[model samples]
Target: MAYSHDSVADIRSESFPDYEARIEDAYIEGYDPASLGAPHSSLHTRKLWFGLGLILAALFGIGLSVWGAAAHIWGTGTQIDLSNRLLVLGLIEVAVTLTLGFVLIASSRKGYKEYRKRTGRVN
Candidate 1:
């Protein structure tokens, strides 16, 4: 193994056995478990935020669709027809949000579990 980044261009076949071990050690040492905790935890936070946002959006859309339907049914306020796409869109949003939220929560839990197992960090 060669330390040079451009080693691909310089094809010298003399093997340095220690280089591979040194590189692996350096890579492992770069991550401090005490400081970083678990790397996937950050990703879990992001996924949770995104999923909640989607859920909120879905709720808003559903509210809008219901309001429109109510207006049409009551025949008093601004009437949006039953054929309006808002109802369909709102239903789709709800399905998508629920699916994504479940997936994110499951994956994040698995990742955190794996990280804890690897680090042997029991808490």
Candidate 2:
């Protein structure tokens, strides 16, 4: 037999009398109750690694673009050409990589600051 809505509600209320208060407390604490067991240091470290990885990838893209531009301009048996579609594409790639790297770094720094503030850590 299936429990009616009222019966379910009654059972829930009987089992958890302070559910509303607990939820309110969780809100005030600025985190979900389900995440209580996870350590904040792990989250911080993961963010650091993610930020570093993005920076490295961005740098790699910029380096590849620079290398391609140099090779196109200075390689043997190739005439020196300044005005080319490939140069424009390489410049665009550099600009995009720089923009993405800056944004990710800034956001990660901001998140680290917030984490420090939340955890009351000075260092």
Candidate 3:
């Protein structure tokens, strides 16, 4: 279904100005802005996608690393050597994966904060 501006009420809300400006900008560019949805600048969309992708990738990496570490430590199919260097390496992989996940989350949060700051919506 195509987007219609008539569907949205004229009653201004908190994000009305931002949305209005975007619509007006698109209209000036000879395009219907109704399809644009809310007030997302290109930079905002790119940053949001990047953040989401980073989070997803981090989650996958963390899960894979943890699984690999656990399989090494407790799986019966592999030779069990508690004092072996492989144990230490597996543990290190788990720790590093956790750290990477944390860092990705922090970076995503920071990016969101920066976006809010730029949009003057710091609250």
Query: What is the TM-score of each predicted model, taking all chains together?
Result: 0.47, 0.42, 0.34
Q: Encode model 3's per-residue lDDT on 3-107: one tens digit a residue.
A: 999987777664466543422333343343332363433334544455455545555545555666666567747555433444455556556655665565565
Task: Please report the candidate that would top TM-score against the real structure.
Answer: 1
lDDT of 2 by residue, 21-115 (tens): 32223444445433324343334454556656656666655665676677676762555554354556666766775667666666656744765
**Residue 82, model 1: Cα distance from true site in angstroms:** 4.9
Q: List the residue pairs that clash in candidate 2.
A: none
Error of 3 at 73 (Å): 2.9
Predicted model with the maximum lDDT = 1
Local distance difference test scores for all models: 0.60, 0.56, 0.52
Off by over 4 Å in 3: 1-36, 40-44, 76-123
C-alpha lDDT of residue 118 in model 1: 65
Q: State the lDDT of candidate 1 residue by residue for 26-111, as single tens digits.
A: 33644544424544464537776776666666677677668656555565345445535666766676788778877766655776
Poorly placed runs, candidate 2 (over 4 Å): 1-38, 42-48, 72-83, 109-111, 118-120
Candidate 1 residue runs with Cα over 4 Å from true position? 1-44, 76-84, 115-123
